[model samples]
Target: MRRTWLATAALALAAALLVAGCSGQPLSEREKGTGVGTLLGAGTGAIIGAAVGHPAAGAAIGGALGAGGGYVVGNSLQNRQAENQQTQGQLQQQQQEIENQRQQIEQMRQQQETE
Candidate 1:
């Protein structure tokens, strides 16, 4: 039983690493979260299932639930990040416009002084 549990754990770790390394490009937050969640959930589920004699089934169910939850959280974070970036862009643009106006006002002042 101890050997079986160790083997299961090893297999889970290997699977997680494989999944994590499958992508060459940088993973999005959602993808990273999903991978992490799957790893954690599967491991936990395997342990629980072993207690009840159904490790594989437990792992599957746990993985699915974890993936869903992780995706939701990651997606929310991604959306917030996008919103913040957009807000920053708008602020920068507004600052630029204000500077342009200041420059124009200075030019007018110079013209008036010249006249």
Candidate 2:
């Protein structure tokens, strides 16, 4: 019983450390998802494994599956965000071009009026 408790605590601490290690930079959606998933999975797995007398194996398997699932979801979100940014950039460029054309037309009109 004590051993199981210690194992669970160690796994939790390790998971926390893994997340803390990534705090040096702003985490993207994918990274955040992966961290969250791994932590949740490990904790849950440990509980379930304790019932079956295999906490470590359960934690390892759960963590791996969680990470993979998190990555997939996070990757999709990242791609969508990138697409949105690209669209916004294109719109801004078009707006700038329009403004430039308007300025040129104004200049042409001013020249004609002076003539």
TM agreement with the true structure for every prediction: 0.76, 0.71
Best by TM-score: 1
What is candidate 2's lDDT per residue for 3-114, written digit by digit as tens?
Answer: 6755776677577767777679777878767777877777687688878988877777777777788788888898899999999999999999999999999999999999
Error of 1 at 76 (Å): 0.9
The digit string of per-residue lDDT tens for model 1 on 1-115 reads 5557556755876786677677676777787777777767777877787789888777777777777787888787788888999999999999999999999999999999999
Please tell me which predicted candidate would have the highest lDDT against the true structure: 2
Model 1 stretches astray by more than 4 angstroms: 1-23
Provide C-alpha RMSD values for all models, in order.
Answer: 3.4, 3.3
Clashes of each: 0, 0
